[model samples]
Target: MDSFVNFFKKIPNKFASSAKELGKVQGIAIIAMLLALRVVLGMFANIGLAFNPYVKIGFTFLPMALVAYYFGPVCSMITACLGDVLSYVFAPAGASFTPGITAGYIIEACLLGIILYKEKISLPRTIICEVLVTLIGSLAINTYFIYMFYGLTYLQLLGLRAATLIPWAIIEGILVAVVVKALNRVPAISKNLPTT
Candidate 1:
């Protein structure tokens, strides 16, 4: 029993010593998975629900910010922005101005990436930060660019109602928190992130 406990205690410190660290690879894989998920989800949403065009399932930035939370903003921010660009090229969901919305998406991702890059990755902190990012980002920061580029009012563009959108935002936050938690159980995945 003593030996078993000792061995388990030593496990984490083994991977915590590397300079490049674990989150880099984990960041790579997670970003790739996010891109793939976005593409597949977009395709399904397009086919399955005609009227659900503007409805977004945004787990991308949450994970990106998580990566940034450990890996630094520049690395994770680029990881995120590139993921969005790739998603657009691969999926092509909207007919609106690509450059503009892409810019907004990247901006939004980077902002949270900047903020959470300094914080812990626990659920309570993360969910609140995530919702704040979406509200300030999606509603305030990007609203004007979205309106100008897409030629729709703020309400029309995002389908923004505090009631409707908050639920979705909360759902996205929970989904990201749960998915990251599950990913942490996989040694290969958790092995890549920075130290606790």
Candidate 2:
């Protein structure tokens, strides 16, 4: 129980530390480059399901995961929100701005940070983290946002969106594990990455 309480206590401290990164030039530059990568991936690298306009499979999660792993939750949240806004601005996609969707992205990034920051990058951990993020951030949060926007029943939205969750989680988990492991092989990036 004390351990659980301590874990909760650490969260705010982590967030504070991450928030402070915004003031650093190196942090800002890294985040800016990652944010740009996120926007490009979101705009050009996603595939919309033919049956559901709301369902998109994208690589934006890569940058979000990287930011979370590097800087922790607050910075990840900020990057996610900015990336979402910028993606929308650059490519309107015939939809008005939706804060709810951006909120989902924030939640996604926060979850990733909480799960991955300062932790060993392993396949099982990455898989579990991706699953949880998809379940909470994408399925639960974003589904509701889509329901609100498109006037679809919440259950319908969930049904449609859930179809991609497992596959996405597995594929992304493998990709994240492979990518981080590969990056760890590079001396420059490995120095920046948290040691396992």
Candidate 3:
């Protein structure tokens, strides 16, 4: 479909914009701060759920989401990759390394950046973006990786994921909407906002 093609086309544009933005020292500093925040948040905020072996309720995504919004796809993706890698190293969430899950993080960050960067903050868009990321990254891709790394079957993992991530996605959508709207009040974060 034309929409699908256009969507792919937009990815490169977002990456190019991200690279350009990161060329600035301010941009690099912002990304480093976000990455460090993500790791710290990851270290402290994650609460492993007793109901699921792999599920954890965490607030680390907040910084990564901000990175996606304030920076661009490239920065968001890089931050996500490093943030996750370092978090696992420092925090040790009790899971072994699975590259597929790491890939999911990068995809999730880039997807959010692409959907949200330079766009107006809105409830509908926030919900849509969060749900898409949850479905694709958290549910599908992550479930696959979890199954590969752990012992759960795909169906079992999918069921467990649906139980946790659906509600988490709703909460994440509202949180992102609120935070982004508030951040837009700052001239720095709002600098990238598309002008009417």
Candidate 4:
């Protein structure tokens, strides 16, 4: 009972620490770099499966995940939002700009950031974060946008995306785990990062 109570108590402190850490110069620089990376990576990722133009599988998530791990949700959200807007400006993939998709990107980054920030990137955490991100960002949110703007059924979009996104999510979990482990080995970068 006491352990449960303490766990709940600690959650707020972790969030506070994460929020505070994002105000520093290093944090700002890291966020900027991540935003740029996301845009650059978007070039490679903008193309979707031929059958379904809404499903975009890409390597951009890795950098967003890293920003979340090192800087937390606030920075991650900013990076995601800005990256999406700029990526569109630089390379208009579809017919027009859809704010719903941009919102989905922000939500994805926030979810990933909240799940992985200040937490050791173990198999469990990595898998859980990837699953949540895939479901929320790719499946739920993206599906909605596609259905609304593209006149597709939600189920249809979900079914089409699942074929690729499920396997991609698993691979993403492994990739995130590997990157986290490698980053942990670099004290110069990881040492100064605040826990949570």
Best by lDDT: 2
Sort the predicted structures by TM-score, highest score first.
2, 3, 4, 1
Between candidates 3 and 4, the one scoring higher on lDDT is 3
* Ordering by lDDT: 2, 3, 4, 1
**Candidate 3: pairs in clash:** none
Which candidate has the highest TM-score of all? 2
TM-score of 1: 0.65
Query: Which clashing pairs does model 2 show?
Result: none
lDDT of 1 at 183: 67
Model 1 bad stretches (over 4 Å):
1-53, 61-66, 149-152, 155-163
Q: For each predicted model, how many residue pairs clash, with residues at least 3 apart or on different chains?
A: 4, 0, 0, 0
- Worst lDDT run of 10 residues, candidate 2, spans 187-196
User: Global lDDT of each model?
Assistant: 0.57, 0.86, 0.83, 0.80
lDDT of 1 by residue, 151-175 (tens): 5677777664344456766776776
lDDT by residue (tens digit), candidate 4, 52-157? 5667778998899888888777778878888889988998877889999889988998888777777767877787788888898878887788787666678977
Task: Tell me which residue pairs clash in candidate 4.
Answer: none
List TM-score per model, in order: 0.65, 0.90, 0.88, 0.87
lDDT head-to-head 1 vs 2, winner: 2
